[model samples]
Target: MKFIGRTVVLLLIVNILLVYMHYKQAGDVIAKDSGTPTYQQEIEVMNRSDALYIRHHFSGLSQGRHEIIWPEASADRSCYALDAISCGRLDASLTAFVDGDNEKQSISYKIPKENSESQAMLYHEPFVTLQGATVTSTLFHITDETRSGGMWVNGLEQVGSKQMDLIDYTFFQGSGGVQDLYWQQNSLPLVYEGEKLAVYGPAGHTEQFEAVDAALKTIGADHSAIVIDQTSIAVQSQRFIVSENADIDKASTLFLTSAMAARYSIPQQERLLVEVVASILGDKAIGAEQSRQAYDKLIVALTPEELALLKEVVNSKAGQEMNATILDDLIKEVTGFKTSYFKTAIQKDTADHLFLFEDTREVRVDGTSYADIGIVLKDGKSLYPAKSILSHLGYTVTANEQSLYIEKEGRKFRFPRKEPFYVYNERKFDVRTSPFEVLSDEVYFEESWFRRLFLLTIDKTAETIDIVNLSTVLEEVIE
Candidate 1:
């Protein structure tokens, strides 16, 4: 009887063990089908997903050059927020992704919810709001769901490279819940000023090409741009002479790089082409719609008298063209604006005595500074100097029939209003009232540039401006 009882106990133990194994296999199947990971299967999908951004400390990007930046997340960002800037103050989310060996063992992580775009001085971590499975719930559900990319080796890190052209990649912008999208070209051709250009979209459709039309419109290329089919982009410009054999692939690089660098690789010749184009096209490169809006915003930033004075300046040939040239150069040289996008790199002034204006990016200095930089506003056919803008900041801006003059901070500047006008730099310039130009009555500096070019022309002492002290300038106007 004792032997029989012992045997029965052993059989029961074996039966229980077999049942456990069978259920474990069943659980695995269910997890796969339900899209829910079992306790051990979470990492399996991760390894399979090939989330390449894991290699980066900033949001790991999966493809085309990603401009992933570190973050400084905050809750009350209103104090430092600007409409042009999408990001505000914040702490670091400090997000991370680590690879592991287990296929079935699940590893968990929390993705940060905030997407900060405005550039700060340093790459700071964002604040993490959740952890574990809840972490995924709190973060955004953005995905390259198409899974349409192959791995591309970049730097020491390998990232997933999508087979997208630069146009499609840099055309759209993703902001919080809103998305801005545009079409793309398979291959694009670039036109540099002084070069003859042939414009076409897809299937060899050549319509209006070069800066012929873009230069005339006050708003610019994005709005008046001629696109061919769904693949080609033609941004009109007055700067370059186009070659009949201009290659589209090379030009595409110029447009792509000028628009977004991380998204495309441009050859040196193409870069030269962009510089030339930017030099001639100036602010007219921004779509007409955008320029109109910019003008409206800037008007709000100015005082009643300042706006009036600015209007007068924009009407002048020198004011219109010079400002357009300066504005476009600043955008391309600093913040890049292309077909439908704006990619800006915000850097703080390195000079110890310099600070950004509390309300804007314009630099300011305390004490006595010789140089006074005034942002020229576009008003009608004339370029307007905001006399009120200069006066409020303790500068005296005066304009006569033949010239625009200013004494601000400590520097003095004189701009010729009519033809045969030469900057202090003595470079030959054109004050053309071209019918096919953005500013019909404005003067364009065919051979001159603002500060960057100005500095090259004029010899000057280095001085810093305090943007901090200028905060009051905006405080009085914004309200």
Candidate 2:
């Protein structure tokens, strides 16, 4: 037994040593060429401030030529790119490098003291060294409101004995919800002329593409001759450029200019005015008949003073410059003429001694029109259809004989039939009015209940009730 125990102990010790040796060999291989770069890029975007700081580290380099490209690098007379090796004023693009020595190198750049518009910062490395290399590219984006920031990394490739091309990094920063949906649609692959081409912006605005296509079609431009995505719109053999962040009016004007330039030529000034006007009318200006109708509506809606202001602005230098802010102001002034579509309507009927009166009002939820869903008007109160609205907002709504339950993401609500109180999560709360059954499967509650429960904005007009979910609009709804 002692001999057996001694043999077991010796085997355990030998196995442990062998395992340690194997790990050591693997660690050595990892240390030599683990595909991870020796250096990294760090970026910090200060909260509630316009300050941006970026640091780049180049630790393990061979004695050879290497380069770093920063596409978003820009400098004024006061600001410049700085490093231990060299410092220079940056132009639209910055290309910095180290040569002949293998010492560790780094660079740091800071934006100017003044506040600037939010932008995208991109980093690229394209070079070869004696030792094999791994290239990493990063993009940092900051929103204009400074409310949010994001970073993305890409182009991780092991470069062995061959140079790398400049990595393409597409960065998109957009307000959430419908805007995000549009961006997603724009990013989809578009097929044109039996060929697939990727679109990247600083260019095409997807929303304006349909209108531009319609106008082009009216003017004898081939329907398939132009292709558009959120990034850039290609007109057969030509490419038109518009900023991804361009407003509807500006994007429409630029697209119209491009389309006209490709096919039917138009005077620049006249085209600008026409495009701005069409864009202001939105999709209503898609065809000639709709354009005439939109024009008539605009004329009828504008007051004499507003008309004079519009004319003055259109003839002024700002209008000639197609200034976005000024055009936005004009749009705000004319927005009353814009049409609103509703999905459902509530009909109220009242009976008197000798007469019957009936009234109907349209309803909209979150700017979406539902033709089949409706609200109920009872005893001078607006009663909302609980299940339809909640379900439409992506809630799971279930009902029993006694109570109705609603849940979405993590929020929960329960209302006992004919009760003036509701339970949210595990907590109960009182309400001024109770929920009641209008039909076998339909239950209705006062508008205040929905407003309080869902953080909705209820805008009641004579002809319509606009129920906008504040959480969805702000893109802050719980997951």
Candidate 3:
């Protein structure tokens, strides 16, 4: 009997060992699979290569040539990379070798979508021809598609009875006389000569001003005056002067020049500028208005001279020529003036303002009242009846002895009755004000809690506490 019992115990031990080994083997398989790079990761690597190719080669490509060489193994992934890099502005056609001997294939991408349709119609062969024994010709042509009749080209000999638009004719005729003007217009010029600093570009091109300003500030050129001009708008300090033909279509030159000029600016200021630029660039996930507000606040702290320089650039002819959205971006890129925590910090500072109302205020949800209880104004902060307001807004509100639970659809929020933090998806976030109970039944929450959790807008007036549903506001906007 003792031998039988020992055998049973031995079998039980063996079974437990087998179960543990099975789980360990399964876990190892899962960890190995997870360690392997995904298709998305491979695609991202290809995309980076595609972006580098475009950045280095795009501008240097001859007119009418936009071909990119990609690895044959990932040639099929070019479309995804191009779309992402260009933000849907560009599309490509893959051309693979029939023999498949080469490791690389060529993918030809089309021009931006806005220009692609009219491109073929706009440019025709043999519009102008040049032949000479001793005469050398330099041609410059620019088309401002956003404006009506804003095209101009230099050194185009008109063919018989072709009848080109008057706006198409270049303002200056000869190469010798307008060479400096041509260079200034075609490129970004940060030229300083004899107490006069000249930056040539659109007034809306803030980057040009930023680079020139940083350079000047670094060199302590406080006595110098800046001359900024384009074709239609010109703003100059009393000491500086500008010519008539200094107009340009290129804003990209400012980016290249600014990168080089940043070396001359103060190192700490340059680092701050880089941080601001990164913040602005990364702010697409937030909103453009947030970035604009941050920029506006930053400029307010600039010195009078700096402000004047900014105003000149923003109100110039070249600035007026740019799209409003593009102008906003340029304004946000203004750097090297003052250091301030931009968007995120500014938002927090603004939100810290707590108001105390003297009069009794009624709660209005979407401009209408669904509950009889008014807002509780305590300690200079407005608190709303949480259960009543949230229930009307389609959220189920329940309370236990220690915590309150608010849920909508699949989303759940847990607020500890005594703690100054809320839990969402098991993640705790500290808040400025903690939720409290009234009369052992009603739960009151701060204005920020509603805004943060549900994106509701709270407008406080003398007589009413207006709680606006953002979706309803958007619908009204759409109408």
lDDT of each: 0.27, 0.39, 0.36
- Give all TM-scores, in the order shown: 0.17, 0.24, 0.24
lDDT of 2: 0.39
Of candidates 3 and 2, the better by lDDT: 2
Clashes of 2: 2
TM-score of 1: 0.17
| lDDT digits (tens) for residues 1-479 of candidate 3 | 54344333322222222222222233333433554211100000101212211111111111222233343222223333333333222233432222222221222322222232231111112111111111122222232323223222211221112125432222211111011111122333333322213333233323333444454334333222222333433321111223222221112112212331232232332322322332222221111334334444444444455555554443232202232233334444443311223322333433122221222456788877644654655566666778778777788988778888888875789988788888987788997667554532457766776687777988877667788878889999999
Q: Candidate 2 versus the native: TM-score?
A: 0.24
Provide C-alpha RMSD values for all models, in order. Answer: 27.8, 28.0, 28.9
Please give the distance, in angstroms, between residue 8's alpha carbon in candidate 1 and its true position after superposition.
Answer: 88
